[model samples]
Target chain A: MKNNVKKLSDYIDRLNWEKAPGAAECGELENLYAAVRRVKSLKPPVMPGADFPDKVVQSLARGIKRAKSRKRLLKSAAAAAAVLAVALLVYFAALKDTNIVSAMERAYGRVSAYHGTLEVVFTSGAGERQVQSVLDVWADKQGRYAIGVLEGAYQGLMTVSDGEKVWQSPPGEGALMPVFSETHEFIFELGGEIEALKAAQSARVAGEETVAGRPAYVLEVTPQGGLPYKLWVDKETKIPLQKEGAMHNAIQYTTRYIEITFAESIPDELIQVEGKNFREADIGEEESPAPAGESPDEAFEPQVRVEVDMQAEQAQQIAADSGSSPWRLDPVFTAQVFVSLQISPEGITGEYPVDYEDFTIARTDGRRMKVQVSSDKTEIKAVYLERLVRQDETGIWTVVGYDISR
Target chain B: MNEEGLKFAAEVCRQTWEPLYRYVYHKVQNREEAEDITQETYIRSLAYPKFREIGRAEYLAFFKAVAANLVKDRWRRNKKRGIQVGFDAAANLAFTEDPAEAVGERMLVEQALKTLSAEQRKVVELRIIRGYSVSETARMMGLKAGHVRVLQYRALKNLAVILSKEETSHEE
Candidate 1:
């Protein structure tokens, strides 16, 4: 009789799912629809080395120090590791048969936004690095609204999200450089929603586990999306403890929230800050200063800056060819100084038709200077020898080096 | 793996390896890159002495955070060089069979998910696909178990409504 009931329930479940258009499409459902897909091919566990003992001792020492210094008054003089150990021990000891999933949900429902300095260490394929941030995270009563200010290694970046829109300055301002999504919420929650990578295509749930001493459900979600992120959620607290993924543009990251505390007393000042334009500051830093008397009109108007560089070999070459020309000056005796003039934005301020081959100067808006030469390695090569000056985006003009063919 | 360490590693690996792979594959859209990152995640986890002490939630959270940062880094480098890597490599490994069907279905689901709130979508994913026990799903989402169940029910109903609308439109 009981088996029949279970069968009926299963049938209903299948029927309900089939009827729901809201269900993943037939094609989508098939991808994730594999029944009883066993998770095998386990990589033999690599044991923590003898170094574990020492590390554990050190961790204990650190924990004690932290407990002593903790201002919250909730933590005891116990080691942080010990605190975690004891919590897990107590949880297991009391409710040996308790349903972990239910306990977790009850605790998670109480979750609220936390604000504090969360020292985040980021490792990537390139190298292992740390990003220590004093982050201020706030969520509305509904837990949908959130905003944070992260101060890491490079610069301070703000993540303002109304449970929706998020924006930040480029990393030239010393923050995580933007990629894929232009916003923080989009990037952070890729595992949650953004399906461009086809998450459901290759996703599965692993068994139960514990995080931060709280029993947590393990969801092994692999998406057809190129990059996969592992999510470990506390079954008890329903908070995320560790997230491992690609790091540092190239390296992988093993990000863990070591000491997590939820405080109801997060002052408004903690989340609030002076709003300043940081992107502009960074752009200003990269830009060159504008030259004096270089008014916009002067920049637009035509002006001639003639550059003359003496080349003896070129003189000799010109002299060698002079015998074929009507001009009577001995090229060998005359200094073949390569003279080139740059035209301003207005138009050709000046032009010398004689000495140079195909020598021409043209001007265009934004780009004022142009050099033209017909042929002859000597003149063509000589024209490129002089250095050039350009005004950068910051309205500053600075000398730029040029490679001259010898 | 020490008894404790072994259990922790296995649990952590089981919980995360899939999502990490998916997360990396999606962002980098390359299998070898995703695999490399996934393997690297294990290596990094091995380095931490607290691996045994780590809670599953923290482990997964750390993994996602790391993967997200890596994706950003790769995205930046790729953008600077203006190179586009094909999604074939990652997609191939992700859907061992039926790539087209799998990808199409996932796209549809994700498209629909986007129309919902992030919280709602998360609830749906955890409840519907991963099949987390109600309490467990709530804990992972950091919401009350009741809230998780309530949200799951509502999200599912809404999704059903949406799917029905889509079907009707298609018929038209």
Candidate 2:
């Protein structure tokens, strides 16, 4: 009998499930094999409940909220000390490059909009690859801006900001994605901010050069803890004609702005999508149970509760656990870390910081939290967790609610 | 987590939840407990700061490890409950009573199958469930025939231990 059991186990191990015992087979061993076969035939049941996905998503939203509040507390505590140190450095450095900095500032200040061509070159295993894209940008003094990507793999991708609401058209997605206001502040507004100039490590007039047949003054500006890049300010109009720099210290890629322009009154249609066919999706929040004494529609808007303070250590732990950098959540936009394009001198090129900042809570209702992140100087991304009602089948007019989920 | 990270995590959950829940349910033997353990696995995974950094295969492995530990913890907690019925008695009762009871007994065996590693599970699923031959299973899983045999041996050995526990509890 023992030998029969051994023989049955060995035969099963050899993938001979269908092989029967000999004419003198032991009944006990045969019963065990039949039991095993019967068990193997039973299928596993599906997840026992419906709320499981919702429960998991809700837990995630809570986790994100806890992480964000903690990060905010840490940032506030550290901001003052860091600001003092940065202020002192800026004050000392400001004296040396006042003239050149002012000239570049004035040049960028007057531009309401610009049309230009961006040509990037980089080295790859096969050698060099050159990518050329048309750059169109519209900026207003009130901090509203729109950028259109007219060529490359990201040719149709567009980002627009109306100061309060930021919208993005991700490549291949015909709908517009509404994101947090801060996302625009981080990504779309270029180096025109005076604070950015004040933050520069050094600024100097490199020399005069002609860019695209226009004579220009090349002002080299190096931000603190950032790469040094040159701006060719047009000699006649004081507008920047070209910009050149290596995007990263680790990767040897040079990016150059080959052409540029400044325009008055950029048409509103270019920045804002006008249609009814788009579908809007919210990425971060999950549907939560409605509060007492409220209609379902009213309860859909989450109420804000008490904020949880987070320390740097907690943020670090979360970041470490999430396999992400803590600096991604920091509001301070450091130039070297945030620059958008990398082009090799050999013309092989790619976009830098391919995604937005690490996940951060843009807003939270008592029930759901919205996760949104701003790109350094190119894109704004939001993870849509909820589906919004839309009018058309082609899914053309997706309107993201900019209102903070209370 | 970032959008990409969240997207990746959502994909992982969508793909692995069933297998993970099945693995947990077999060891724990309660639907609610299995679901709780599965949820805990995901919640615990949130701490793995580089969730997006790892590949799908590595993430699934990590998830299984977490589930297995939870199951072990559950077993340790329930150890003092003592066996309710002898293995032979339960088998006899299952056969004589409602056929539904036999189905329940089969479920216990199915649960035991969940204890196998992903590789072993693949071997069982291919060779046993799909009725593939040894060489065929090996080719499908990209493993050597000898390795497949070893996996099958270990898997069945583990299943035997689980089945034996039922008898041992009955003896107690």
Candidate 3:
């Protein structure tokens, strides 16, 4: 046992000789220790629920039998399969760089790269004007858009855009990601969400059509999964518009480019929207921000972005518990925000106004935001954009961007 | 394949398959693929003569090396076909209790994990999650114990730094 330990140590040392320099003794030491452990493990433990080794041995025996036969059979099939599969793979690989794909990708890129702010208005039955502010714009190559809506400005606040990933207001906002956007493109007011519509297990290019007074190609896209999307593309500009998806609960998007302009000298500032708070994006990392001055409603628009982390409250709580502010959550916005709070850290110390969600909450250290019952409901709805208000330390108040449906 | 080589491969499957399965389960988060790779590791070990000379620790080290290679290869092949590879949808649904909190932690861990190199990530996962000792880890990963310690330090430092930066940005 002593000798084995020394050998294992030696083996371990040799592996790190570059860093440790000249550790021959260590390599042999590791080898000996490894040998001892291996031998010890060979004797199965007496404990209950220890069937792994036996099962492993049995499985291996079966695999050996199967592998031999598989090799023999595959040898014959591989020759034919390799020829066809390789040819197909290469052909598809080559097709990726074609004009058709480029046109489709360009359309998708147009939507994904769109950046600009627009206010969406939903006039309710009572002529009550509700305005929602949109931020950060980007679309996918498939013409799907992800947009971020200002949570405080909208009640039951959430952002919706078309893409594989759907973004919603972070938790504590009582907002769940709406499912309609997943099935329909029109629900979010996105135009031309799909670029290359695949049908019958292939990309389908439907004949020509006219869209918004522009000559366009109507492309039929049938996805193997999810609802199929129908796209209309501008023939001259190679731009697409009006992508409609879903058959059962069909959603249609009508896009009228009110105006189209391209600038070769694209300003970097146009793409950057300072102070926009982005939640965790549904898309993976390397998610592109929206392009400059483009409507957020364009299909494949980039998701709404916020400068502050959404989980600021949880992080604050952790810090409070740990007795140190190891983490801080601050709201980032280009514009100055004014807020009034109902709750405060020192227990109902009245209200004060501040700009941006993170800043407002940071002032109070995550105190609850509530609407006082004594307040007139109608007046509250009309004046205050949000329903609840909370204040942190430093006497800064934040509008609680949450839905108070009840 | 040599007789000893096949025996070593079989022994490797017997000793390391389950933990390996779990390790891969966390990375790709798929049971079917994890099982498939676990089986493949055994079959592959037979092709290398070094298998006969290695013990449990060395065998584990070899298997992990192969598993990492397979994962990259698998991802590339799937990507070529436009198939996105990552966590399975079913895995997300399985979390019913405190789903919000669980999801948050998972995202944080994933974001943190992404910062480490493949080798560093593997060492951290094995030593931290699998509870492998320095000695055992060195043997299984075929690294010197000192190298494992250095990798561990780098992994932890990277995670701490990344998390801290994110927190600072939030606070600001």
Q: Which candidate is the best by TM-score?
A: 2
Ranking by DockQ: 3, 2, 1
TM-score: the better of candidates 2 and 3 = 2
lDDT of candidates 1 onward, in order = 0.39, 0.49, 0.41
The TM-score obtained for chain B by all candidates, in the order given, is: 0.38, 0.43, 0.44
Higher-TM-score candidate of 1 and 3 = 1
Top lDDT prediction, candidate number: 2
RMSD of each: 28.9, 30.3, 24.6
Q: Summing lDDT over every window of 10 consecutive residues in candidate 1 chain A, give the lowest-scoring window.
A: A35-44
For model 2 the local lDDT of residue B153 reads 58
Model 1 interface Cα RMSD in Å:
19.1
Angstrom error of the Cα, residue B158, model 1: value is 61
Residue-wise lDDT of candidate 2 within A1-406, one digit each (tens)?
3455445444443323222222114444444554444444454433467667666666665665455555664677577678778999897587455665675577677766654444433322333333323334566665666665543323445666666555566555442333322223332244553445557788677789876555687778776654566666667666655545443323323334444445685577765665723222232332333457865455334232222233543543343222123122222111113223221233324433433224433433312334454544333343222212211111111112222221
Between prediction 1 and prediction 2, which has the larger TM-score? 2
**Once model 1 is optimally superposed onto the true structure by TM-score, how far is the C-alpha of residue A272 displaced, in angstroms?**
5.5
The DockQ score of candidate 3 comes to 0.06
* Candidate 3 deviant stretches above 4 angstroms: A1-406, B1-15, B24-43, B49-58, B68-172
- Candidate 1's C-alpha runs over 4 A off are A1-112, A116-120, A124-136, A141-151, A157-218, A246-250, A262-406, B1-172
Q: Distance from true position, residue B91, model 2, in Å?
A: 99
